[model samples]
Target: MESGKLLKAIIESAIDGIITIDNRGRVESLNPAALKLFGYKLEEVIGRNISVLMPEPDKSSHDGYLHRYQSTGEKRIIGKGREVRGLRKDGSTFPFRLAVSEVQYDDRVIYTGFIHDLSKEKEAEQRLKEYAAELEELVNERTKSLKKMLHALSEAKEEVSLSLLKEKELNQMKSRFVSMASHEFRTPLSSIQLSSVLIEKYAEPFDNPHIKKHVSKIKNAVGNLTTILNDFLSLERLEAGKVEPAFTPFDIVKLSEEVTEEMQMIAKEDQNIIYQHTGIESMVNLDQNLLRNCMINLISNATKYSGEHTFIEFNTEVTDTQCIVTIRDNGIGIPESDQKNLFQAFFRAHNTGNIPGTGLGLNIVQRYAGLMGGELHFESKINEGAIFTLSFKR
Candidate 1:
């Protein structure tokens, strides 16, 4: 009696739902917690089967499970917690975590169950899951926006780089054009002035031959000026995309002769231009006007900077598909420090100090060479000489 009373007190005081069943699986006891967990009272469930608290199929087949356990001694729900449904007094059902334990007392077998309510825990777990989903969504959104911003930044940088490159190219072209125009214009202006002065001073006092010579000089100077202006206009046309290369068969030797003859008087007293043609005398397709200007610029430069009696050598060699021309001069050669800026506009060599020049000769020569599908190459040694080579494809 004392032991039964002690067990009753322990069952009623349990924090978890406590229930006990007899050896025949009948409900023997029900605790206060069990009453609250299942919405049943001791008077209602104590004499009924333990399956009264279960719903549906379990309520019908639980006796068989107990019979099998007794026969084989297998334990399924005993000493383990599992999720199951329970019945309430109102005929409604609620989910729970159920644990059952078996105890033996005085040849009687008893089962005790502890039940835990799951609604509150399930609600808490669902809330945590919802928070996690929201966090993942926020991270994906931020990542997408950051990636878009990075791509835009990359495109902006590329545009800035391209713009800067174009600006640099324009500046270089402007410098070259300005230098060539100044030099080319100055040459003709000087020639025209000198010729006019000679004609004015000597035409009345000198013989007919002298007057004729003066007039010829003025005409030649005017013609040269016209050529220079035409070359400048051609450059403008090329830059404006209006001029295309005219390829036609022509003799490079003939072009060299004409240029040297035109510049003969300008050559120093000690310097004379010599043209040597080597290899086959075959005609190559090229821009005649552009090639002529390139040769003229090179030859004129040689004449301008060379000593009084130095030899200005013009040599040409033709291969199967190309023609190479080299103009060499033994004069005050360019300094090493100024070699890099040779093709820059208005950048005259230090050696040409006080020399009458506009400093666009090399720049124009380089541009003309490029226009003719050729390249201009040079070599210079201070006080030794300079060699300029123009190579064109056949």
Candidate 2:
């Protein structure tokens, strides 16, 4: 009697839900845990078919399974754990793990089932599946955005390449036009100059001021046009990389004197260009043609900008280490702001007013100096004077 009470106490105190059924599958007893798990009282479930606590197909098949097992002694759900659903008192269902074991009593048989709830684990698994689907969708959206950006960059690169090709063709055509026009205009310009000189010579005997003035104007206009054509031709050749200096042994003193004499005829009224050689050595190896052109350009600038009776200083020096030439003039000096761009092609100083110039002389002179491996630098002050120095290493 004591042993029977102890066994009952142990079963009632168990944490897991426990239930016992007769060989015929009728619920005979249940622990307190089993009663609370199904939301039923012991009196309500006692003597009822065990299928009352089962759900769906299991509820309907329990009786046949029990009969088959009793007759054939086949163990299908016996001595093993099965995941199954239990029907609650409110007609709702929940998942649980059920373990059944057949117990042999004195003359009859009974099945005891232990039940562990699994509702929480199943809910957590469903949540994980939903999270994985959301992450995949985000990855797909980012990939699509990246592909669109790459496509736009490719299109932009192609457009830039096309623009560069068109610009190259345009530059080549412009160079060709300049070369042809300069050569074509030269013949007419020479004829105009010659005719003006002849007109001046013939009209001097008549002493007509109008005839002399008009001839002078014609000569000046023709000279200006010739300068423009020459500037354009020089720039075209430089851009095509065709201008190279030819070095030779020449008398510096002779070249300086010759350049001054040639340029003196074109100077502004009464403007004097003084030529001097300060160096002892008279002969030096250099590009004679290029040097003559540079000296002529500088003197012309000085003569053009200076007022009547102003003096332009031209000096040359040849030392053991270097050869130097300097030209200084009192003229409408370049502004401090304009000095920086003095050697840029087609860029005239802002201070120049109504002056006949192509603004390409200094640029060409600088380039010519560079081809001879020389340096050109200058100094100027507004309304005062300007000085340019050209030097070559020995």
Candidate 3:
């Protein structure tokens, strides 16, 4: 191929745009890439000044810039590349990199320019900047939301603490009132009980059945009141931390027999308390008063709940390692639903219909057993039977 033809072919196929201008800044030649970059035909741009392809002040001032550089030999955009705008044939503008070179052939001087389109690169950079801004905004929003949630949780925790303190104060006030009322009522109730018994003895001369019956009713009523007051007193004392175990070596068998005898007198017609002892050792170190109270409470419950002719089994076994006492009854047993709350203060079984009770006996007994380093446990099913066991470690 000829050198000139080869040069022309290279200019036509070049990816970057190429343009040539004379010393007067008139367009001398434009490669195919340059023509496409300016959206102009080759023939149309041949004789025009290269400034026609520029926008705004650059279009008007480009001729003076070239003139000044030629005269003063000062370099601005002549040798080094610079970012500039190009105006298309449709009057739209775009960014490009423009590099100019001065060429001298004999006496003629020309400027050659190379252009690189910068549209895609600038668009991508803009998009990345937008994405970075959006990411920063999302992070800030999440952090603010988390801080609000933490503040709300802190307020809720403080409210819960205050409510708990108020509840504790109310419970203390209730305990004080219960203790005072129970203590004051016991004296008058005891007096009523003694007067009723003495009246029954002194009025025997009248021998009237009606007088005897009414006197007996007064005595029974007073007895029930006294029992209720005693339960209140015991509970108050326990809550006040005044009740402590006094351990001593004593005969558990004898204690069980005595409780059984006392409870039998109050049992229903034909009802009996059957007492039995196992294990050779009856002498165990325990809080005798607390143990006796537990026995009396269990036997009393059995006497009240069991029908006529039913027998309450009060069995005890003292071993070298432990002492076990179990009171079992075949009576209206505790309901499955009520059993969970059985040891709670003032809780009563639903099956106890019309029975006179303060509902504190079992709770008191359980507490007494705990003071004496013993455990109280029970098993029951509705209308089947119930067994209460007390165990003490030696």
Candidate 4:
């Protein structure tokens, strides 16, 4: 009797809903959990068809399913758990998991069903899906923002690189300017000072030959100063876009002769300038002053770089469509490595280490030639000789 009471107490207090049905499918007993799940009182549901707690089509077809099982002794949902819908007394439907089992009595069989509500589990699963979608959208937005930041950083880096490059170029130009001002200006200034002192010392004794020699030295120093000043001024004007070439008809051969004669005064001792004219005509249309400056630069370089007594050739040829001048010198020729930068300002050759120059002559000459619609090219072999050719369209 005590064991029976204990079993009754366990079933009454169980959390899952439990119900018993007879062989005829009539409700034999209902637990407190089952009454609460179906919203029915013990007396109201007892002896009624157990299908009363089911939602349609199960409500209509469950009796048929039971009768088939009883006749054939075949098992369908017996001893297995399945998801099913239940009807409440308020005519509402709820989802639940149902497990059924059978017990054999002395003369009949009885069936018992266990029920568990699945409303909370379904609701929790739906909440998880919503959270996953929201997280994916947040991640996409963050990725887009990161890409934009990277693009902005790339642009900033490019701007910084350009700024540094411009600064480097400016520094290089300033250094070259300082070097030019120091070397070019000091040489002529020292020469003029020494010659003036010597001229003063010899003036008291009145030596003609000595006075004349010192005067010539002073004149040459002054001329050197003038040439340096002109170079600087021309560079400034070119950079400022203030120089324009004026072309006119002129005798190119006669101009070359005059320039050569002037350069001979400053030529090395015993050096001779060999002038040759091969063209049919000596006249051409060009910028006279600019042409003169270009020739002066070339002839001066030939004289300066050649040894004493070396013969320098100045040849001019005029054609129907062009005028060409060639200046060939037997001097220390340019090294192959230095030829590429020969026309760059402030660039001196490696072989001409002791040669006194500002390194601006060829650069200025090339620019002037370009302005006159002319071309200047050269060929040289180290320790042998060099030839410079200038051509202009008529």
Candidate 5:
């Protein structure tokens, strides 16, 4: 009797709802928890069909299922836990987990079912899903904001780079202008001053030869000043897009001879300007003024850089499609490091120390060559010699 009471106490005190049904499917007994879960009184539920506690198809088919199980001993919902819908006394339905077990006492069979309501678990699961979705949306929004910031930073960086490049170009132009003015103006001014002093000294007695020499020096200094002014003016015109090539057919050999003769008068003592023509054609269509300027720049550079008595070779090779002029001199050539910037405005080779120049000559010549659709190239080694070749296509 004591053991039977203990078992009854355990079933009645369980947290989960508990119920037992007889072989006829009538509710034989139920716990207080079961009564509270189903909203039923013990007297009103006892001896009633157990299907009254189930909803829908399970409520209507419970009798047939029990009859089949009793006749065949088949095990469907017996001895297993599964989710099922339960009916309340108020005709409402709710989800629950159920585990059913069968017990045989002598020739009678009984079934016991344990039930647990699942409402809280399902609600908690739905809340977790909502939180995850909100987190994903927040992450996506932050990522888009970050990408926009990066794009803005990239644009800012590009603007800064362009500003820096323009500033550097301006600085270079300013430096070149100052260097060119100081070097070019000083040379002619010095020559004029010395010649004036010499002419004053030779005026009293009037030595004709010495006076003529000083006068010639003064004339040459004036010419140097004129040439410097012309170069600067030409550069300004080229920059302003005002200069245009005037192409005309002219005698290249006669032009070359005349230029060489003029350069020889200013050449160093015992120095010679050698001129040679290899091609048959003497007359060619080209910009005579620009061609003469280029040749003068090259030949003058050679003579200025070389020592006294050095021979300067000027050779012209003519073809059906083009004319090539080569001016070679045995002189102090360009250094390896300075060769690349040879045609930049006011850029002089480091090896040209003590040589008087404005450093704008090669730059002007290069621009003139480009205007005529020609190219200038050179080969040189330090202290050995330099060869400058100018090619003009007809």
Candidate 6:
């Protein structure tokens, strides 16, 4: 009796509710904690159905749930703790966590349910989940903004690098132009001054041949000066965006013939300048002076680099929408590595190291070609010489 009293004391003192149910779903025993937790006394609930302690919807469904489990030999919440609702003696429903255990005692089946108040824990868990979700969204937004800022910073760096490169290129071009003008112009000017002084001092004593030769030399010097000045002026105009090209229709065959004839005097005595027109002639709109300059530069390059006795050929071909003028030279060809920088200003090929040039010739040609809506292209093999093609859009 003393042991029984002590056992009862232990059951009543337990923090968790202790309840035992029989096979018929009727409560067999209810401890003090269970009675107090459900707002019931042992005398009132001991013989009552366990469904009476459950909330309304659960009260109606508990029998079916137990019958299904018994028929199927399946356990639903037998060993699991899940959120549920409990009914107090006052008819108020409160949230709880429930766990059940099944036992066999002397040929009788019994179920013990352990109930825990779940309101505070559930509310805390819900708040934690909400906080985590909000934190994830904030982190994602910050990452997106960081990516955009990085992209913008990358673009700004690229723009700054490009601007610096352009400035460096412009400064280099100015320096080259200044050096070229000083040397090329001063030589010719000095010659003209000396020649004029000699002619004026010995005007009466000089014979016809001597007089004519001096006069011719002066004229040639002046002509060279004028050509240099024109090239420089054209470059300035192009740089200033002041060239309003007057495009007029012109015959391709006629233009080639005239360019070839003009270049005859400059070609080596043993070299031949051939102009071959492939098929019918075509007419295209372009600036005549700009096209002429382009042609002159190409011809001059051919004359300057070709073998003394080799033939330099000029050939033209017309397509549906484009015309190609090809100038072939048999000379020392450009190295493959140097071809990439061929069109750059002041860039000369390794093979033309000994060739005399202002280096502005091809630069002018390329500029004029761009102005006329055309392109200057070339192909070459070492020792086999080169073929420069001017492609003009119709």
Task: Assess candidate 5 and give its lDDT.
Answer: 0.78
- Give lDDT tens digits, candidate 2, residues 1-394: 9999999999999877899999888898999988988999999999999999998899999999888878897764643478889999999999988888788987889988888887876775454334334333433443344335434433544455478885566456547656655665577668667766765675555466766666666666667767766777787788889998889999988999999999998897888899888868878789998999899999999888889999999999989988899999999999999988899876799978888786889999999999999999999999898999999998
The lDDT-based order of candidates, best leading, equals 2, 3, 5, 4, 6, 1
**Per-residue accuracy of model 1 over 275-302 as CA lDDT, tens digit each:** 8888867577888887777787788778
Q: What TM-score fits each model?
A: 0.46, 0.57, 0.56, 0.50, 0.49, 0.47
* Model 4: per-residue Cα lDDT over 286-382, one tens digit each: 8899989888889888988899989999999999988998999999999999999999866789888776665788998898889999999999999
CA RMSD, predictions in order: 35.8, 36.4, 35.1, 37.1, 36.1, 33.8
Show where candidate 1 strays beyond 4 Å: 1-238
Candidate 2 local lDDT, residue 225: 65
Clashes of each: 4, 0, 0, 0, 0, 0
Tell me the TM-score of model 6. Answer: 0.47
Candidate-wise lDDT, in order: 0.71, 0.81, 0.80, 0.77, 0.78, 0.73
User: What's the lDDT for residue 278 in model 1?
Assistant: 89
**Winner by TM-score:** 2
Between prediction 3 and prediction 4, which has the larger TM-score?
Answer: 3
Error of 2 at 292 (Å): 0.6
Choose the strongest candidate by lDDT: 2
Candidate 2 TM-score versus the reference: 0.57
Q: Candidate 4: lDDT of 378?
A: 98
Better-scoring candidate (lDDT), 3 or 6 = 3
Model 3, range 258-370, lDDT digits (tens) per residue?
88888888788899889999998899999899899899988888878888989899999988899999999999999998998999876799878888886899999999999
RMSD of 1: 35.8
Cα error, residue 253 of model 2, in Å, equals 0.8
Q: Which pairs in model 5 have colliding backbones?
A: none
Better by lDDT, candidate 4 or 1: 4
Candidate 3: Cα lDDT at 384: 71
TM-score of 3: 0.56
